[model samples]
Target: MLFLFFCPGSFGADTDEVFVMEGDSVSLTCLKKNQQDRIKWYYNDIRIAQMNGDPSKTCTDVQCNEGTERFRDRLKLDHLTGSLTITNIRDTDAGEYKLLITRGNSDSEKIFSVSVHDKVFVMEGDSVSLTGLKKNQQDRIKWYYNDIRIAQMNGDPSKTCTDVQCNEGTERFRDRLKLDHLTGSLTITNIRDTDAGEYKLLITRGNSDSEKIFSVSVTGVPAAEQDEVKRKTVKEGESVTLDLDVKRNPNDVMTWHFNDILIAEITEDQSQICTDFQCENGEERFRDRLELDHQTGSLTIMNTRNTDSGEYKLKINSISRRRRRSVSSEKRFDVTVTASGLSSGAVAGIVVVLLVSALTAVGVGVIYHRHRSPRKAVEEKQRASVESPNKEKEIFLQTQIEIT
Candidate 1:
């Protein structure tokens, strides 16, 4: 069990509230301990663990008569400090826990409240909805991002405010926030990298109140950083490959998204490669045209079409050597697929041939007019002379007959 001591808090005189994400381990500490002390841990008044100094005396869950089987083998007890640790915590584990320490008939109690929040992941420019409100519940809802109030709604007067309106002229969320009038669910549109943070929703009903926290993480780079993205142009029916530019690690998880939709993924030391509908629940737009390079994590799109033209984002999640933590980085490519399968040089050659053909036809028409005009004039002159000779003879015969 990997213990994350950061999620737990130190022992306090008052009730200590600890917040953690699901699937994490947390330790509720009881610092004040004595060798002869008898420590017992309970969840919502039900005894779950009891230890009497010795490590062998530690008993948990079914081993104790009053304990329940829900925890099973997931609990660990510290014999010296009397601190309780729970591993692989589920959402059902969120509740109040009490610790009773009996030191020679003097009983002391400590309280620890655990709350499990959800982790939400999204890409830039996508919209995310934070929904934890009960339907038709007439409660006042307030939303806070990074501990700053950004939106709120009241049921009595049906009043609501968001962003600047909630802060009396502050900016930040601005027009991106949408509050549901019925459920008070908040939706943020056109999410940016700066929008990634903790969001808390507080629901108040008379004297009782409840809260839900969501950790939002934006994966890809923001659209405003287009200069960092590589641009590629390919003719239809051609293939284009987007290179990762870095050597692939064995533990790296590579996912490719087109227009914010998952299209391909490579995982498990490159043993698992999926594309289109296989990667997620969506339209199979790629249709077996995608290929993954096992060595470099590069993506190749074969027989590209105009529909493939869009923003392609690659996210790589790998473990960092220095920090020993999972870190992710994104690379984007703006692909443009032309409808015509003609290269630029081929199109230029076609234009040159059409221009030469047009010039040749115009020159041939000018030459034909110049050559035919003189021949047409000579033929007309010959026909006029042939008719003039016959007319002169007829005139002379008519004059002689008149004189006689």
Candidate 2:
């Protein structure tokens, strides 16, 4: 977060430009000094703060304007110097501010123009547009990559040009650039590794010009080299290793970046090795879970989580002793981490099989009992007929009694 201050002589209506990030503080100073001078600040033509010669009549922030809460309590005014400080600024704060100084019967105004910059991240083959313009704007817009003009649009007739069209015979971004004629926004399609760099958008409207910068980072390798990237799939809580598969040199410096963020690094001769926060703060996602092979520079991730699924890129820079140049190479790995349990479909299939097996067993037992009962009753009748006359008579009487 950088704060830029440009103070012009406070007599005429000169404009000063300031650039800052969101959530940053900016001070718009009124350089004119007079004991009896009164100062008032206006944002987009709305009064936001004021300082009077009478100490009891001074007001700042919400006290200045009760009808609007845009500034809230984030505004501060210096009673002595008449400088206005805005704390915790937001995107809406990027606009024009006016400071009026009154001395006796004369009044002078100073203008402050503020702009906020942003960062953008994308994967290879994706499209992203840099935006900072209003609809139907008539300003002349120019887009530059690393300070080289890449695209532009003119207000008159809404003419637009890109890449080789913008600069003669330059085909670096021939078919990948798109410029919006309406809003003057620049879009890059089928983005590549060579397209990852700082982009500046300069808007020229009349005599006042405002610039916005965007830091673009592409995650994966180029489309032509996409087949070379290694892909791995692992279950949760499992460990996966991404092997460099190349012999390590004593003068080689290896670095590993996850989603374009540095997470592990090893210096020449393996003298210094760091992982996660040891390499960069606020990178605790892989804390205590990353390991690097000292000999081959391979990376091993332990206890992997679903959040760890992304692109991991390795860059190796080898310093040549005889040759005064360094050789560099990069390798990418796409990892997919899945949950460590059976899928719902698989579990349902197993349950259905168990239920079918139980039903089949019950049907077989019932059929077997029905077939054996008739044969057993016939065998009992034959034994009774073969008995003696007296025993037969007794059996006949017992059967008659059971019948009755």
Candidate 3:
């Protein structure tokens, strides 16, 4: 970096901008038509250090010995004039540094100051989540991706800005990620492993900055499989299907077992035997009596009898190795064989006894009513006489004779 130092009284220069870098070596050159070589360097308005005055004796001795030990050997000077070179600058060097030159009663001086800056990235999640941001709303913090500004700090709810293509479109987020500008927190639901990457954050308050970084994580749930067993109590020779309702991935192969025995390998298709039952033991009593309901995953028992009562178990197998077999609950169906014609006879006997008792109660009510009504019979005779048409005509004739 090049730096030129001149005084306000000097006629040889324009452009008052002075560039100073912290912790870096800097040289300020003052060009002159001729040189008397009276040079001095000052910090702020105070005279802190100066070079050994000489005209042609090689380089002058550095005067950094006048300041603190931190600036030792960090300062150098040319033998010509008031040009000052500061090497290995520090924060203490941020104050104004001035150089004054006098060559034949002509004088010049230049003063300037400097500051050093550093960038710090602070990110919270594997994905984009702005959690625990101090003054997230009005703070003028610039956002960057690979050091490129996509948007500026504007604390308005109507302002909506996000990556449309981050991790293959925002559609995958689907209510999973909640971006709240008011709180400056990005919450992600059902986060998967693919959402891990590098992120950067740059906070600025008139060039004063600080940052934080954090990692987000997710947990996994174990794989599960289930079996379904159904049982029914059917009358002898009654056809009833026991359905198995199962919820599992297609990678699992569902199976069934009846009466503690597997299904035998058979060539016939149209039988009560379920197709999915694999027979390993011969104890299966309903060998051919059990049939598979192909449409629904159920075992149909055709002509079920009293002998088919027992505990039944349903087994499920997984075609994929990643899944494990889980059996359904044990189902018990008690079969009681009703004697031939016994139920019908009992029903018929109940009907007959009910009808006879009803008729006897009604007859007794009629007889009792007649015996309890002697006064009713006399009232009936009087009512019959008064209501006769002949009696009415005689009464009307009497009334006519009286009126005449």
> Model 1 over residues 1-404: C-alpha lDDT tens digits?
34433224444467877888867888887655889999999999999999985767679987877999988799998777888999987656778989888889788778888987666776686566777745456688889998888888886554578888775425887698888787677888778889999988899888888887778888775445544447888889899999856689978888889999988888874446788888766467888898888888899999999999999988776643432234355667899998875778899999999999999999999888777766665555566557797755665454444334
User: Model 1 lDDT vs. the true structure?
Assistant: 0.78
Q: Write the per-residue lDDT of candidate 3 for residues 1-404, one digit (tens) a residue.
A: 43445544543434344444434566665554245556666666555455434434323233334444435566666655445677765434545666666667777665555332211122221122433344444554433333333223445534444444232234434555554455433444334554433223345555566432223333332332111222245566666665545444444333454455554222223343334333444454665676754444456667667666665544433232321112111223333433234456688999999999999999999888766555555455456568996765665555455434
> What TM-score do all the candidates reach, one by one?
0.55, 0.47, 0.28
Which wins on TM-score, candidate 2 or candidate 3? 2
Candidate 2 CA-lDDT value: 0.76
Question: Cα lDDT of all candidates, in order?
Answer: 0.78, 0.76, 0.47
What is the C-alpha lDDT profile of model 2 across 1-404, one tens digit per residue?
A: 42536475445756877876656888888675588988888888888888787776678756765325777788888777888888877656778988898889998888988875454666676566666655346688888888888888775553477888775326897687777777677777767888888888898888878777777778885655554447888998889999866678878888899999999998774446888888854388887999988889899999899999999988776655532233344667899999989756789999999999999999999888777656655555567778766766666666555444
Which segments of candidate 1 are over 4 A away from where they belong? Answer: 1-13, 19-25, 53-57, 69-72, 88-92, 116-128, 133-136, 154-158, 167-169, 180-185, 205-207, 217-232, 239-335, 339-404
Task: List the pairs of residues colliding in candidate 3.
Answer: 7-109, 23-89, 262-279, 263-278, 263-279, 272-290, 272-291, 273-290, 273-291
Which parts of model 2 are misplaced by more than 4 Å?
Answer: 1-10, 121-127, 133-142, 152-161, 174-185, 189-230, 234-404
Which candidate has the highest lDDT of all? 1
